[model samples]
Target: MSAPTATARRSRTRWFALGAVAVAGAAFVAISVSGIGDNLVYYWGPKELRAAGDKAVGATIRLGGQVAPGSIKPGDGVSNLEFDVTDGTALVHVVATGVPPQLFRDRIGVVVEGTMTRGGTFEGHRLLVSHDNKYRAPADKNVDIKTLMRSTAGLEER
Candidate 1:
């Protein structure tokens, strides 16, 4: 029998430290993956929702589409709203409760977050309006810049 040398002890210590670090890293990755999976909310459009069939029911998902031109209607409650969201191919009826955003209107793109009911209606709790970033000149383009500047010039010093 013989006692271990100083070099042997240092090598063993290094291996042990390396193993601990690997275990910690694995644990962190596992935790992060699980957290992300739990928080994930799948987004579906009208066509996708139709394709989902039974799977879409009872699942909390996000639906994105444009509000149908003539489908906005008052629901059973004051704040309740019913509208058809369409992606030009399919339409899904959405019933939402809460204050609709100012930009929420017919023909505007929207994304609603909620669960779909068994009766084929989406019960939404949150509403998001989508608008394009295209910029255009105003229709009334005859404004005189010098006159406008003169009007505000007196107030600029204040």
Candidate 2:
């Protein structure tokens, strides 16, 4: 081929490669934007969810609340147990038929990870025990307040 024609062909190939790269990049961006909503997580309170009306149907969610006072009914002779948890303003009835930790009790702080059923009941997948402010350290029962505060920063003043 002539010198000028050979150089022109090489330049054309470079531009073609650049165009291919740009198209691939745009396709990747479009796919990422389209899938954004699918990865979103929704946090719900018992009251806010109940108020959602028909929108709450078949949606996966996480609910936070305290175990209702005197509502925990441990199994009579089986692992199955029933309880009610409240978010102070809203209450949700939970049915957990598994072995419960000793910390599980009425009026204690608790979190249940579950999904809401069509019948309005929560089926727990895992149970969490909440702690109170009065936690005592078993290692050092005799540590004075002043020393303990000095050891752990930000806690001494409180």
Candidate 3:
């Protein structure tokens, strides 16, 4: 073919490159869309999660709330841990076999990532605790407000 019709060859090469890019882009989009359905993440409170009926099984989700006080129980054997997560109104049982975070404790905000079991328990593979905001104070009505005000006087307004 030699060097004949240089402009025609250049135009053909450009079209081929453009077509290849378009095909690759389309394939990427298709794969992404298909994978998204399996990766859908839903956040639900403890009570709301229990109300999800049978549809909760086989679906991955995040249980967001505090671990219920006095509801934490270590597994009977050596490999599992069971606990109840509560959002004040409702509580759901959580069964996890993996090692949980060190900060996991009662009355602390936590988000457990895992799939729900058919027996109405969440099996967490990962436990994420929201440890940034934790304040402990007695709920007595007789607490001295004057001392609290004095202690916070030097702090900047947040």
Candidate 4:
């Protein structure tokens, strides 16, 4: 076969470039769409999670609920904490490995992320606390306005 002419060489180069672009685009689409539906993290409250029963096991999920009052307790390790999360209709015991936030308290809203074990307990790796967006002043009527003003008078810039 004779050496390819400049025009023929350019045509082959153009076709190769198009083929490379097509392969890259296909790879990108396949990666972006692969099993994302199956890999999605489930968000479930205690009730819904418990209702799901066997299907809940081994599934990565975010469980949101109130920290059941009087349920917070230390576990085997100093960093390990155990508590029951309740949605008022059901409860899921969570054994987590991490220092819970200082704001963690009874009846406070919390969300734990992890998977449910076959033993029906949630093995959490992360915890988050929900907090109010606005702050409200304490309601105290016993403070004398004159005394309060006098106490704060020294704090004002001279």
TM-score of each: 0.60, 0.52, 0.55, 0.59
Task: Give a tens-digit lDDT track for model 4, residues 7-115.
Answer: 7988999999999999999988877888763455345778888988999899788887777878999887756699998866689999988878887877776778999
After superposition, which runs of candidate 2 have C-alpha atoms over 4 Å from their true positions? 1-43, 76-78, 136-158
- What candidate 1 gets wrong by more than 4 Å, as runs, is 1-42, 76-78, 140-158
All candidates in order of TM-score, best leading = 1, 4, 3, 2
- Cα-based lDDT at residue 47, candidate 1: 84
Q: Is candidate 1 or candidate 3 better by lDDT?
A: 1
Clash count in backbone of candidate 2: 0
The candidate 1 region of ten consecutive residues with least summed lDDT is 149-158
RMSD of 3: 10.9
Please write out the lDDT profile of model 2 over residues 1-158, one tens digit for every residue.
99999999999999999999999998888777878534553345567657865676566566556667679887766555888876567888887756777877665556567777788887776776654454458687785653332211111122
Q: What is the lDDT of residue 18 in candidate 2?
A: 99
Candidate 1's TM-score: 0.60
- Clashes within 3 Å, all models in order: 0, 0, 0, 0
The whole-model lDDT of each prediction reads: 0.76, 0.66, 0.70, 0.76
Those runs of model 3 whose alpha carbons end farther than 4 Å from true positions after fitting are: 1-42, 76-78, 132-158
Q: Which candidate is the best by TM-score?
A: 1
Per-residue lDDT of model 1, residues 1-158, tens digit only: 24578778889999999999999999999878768744453467788888889898987889988788789997776567999988777899999988788977777768899988889899999988766443335675765533332211112222
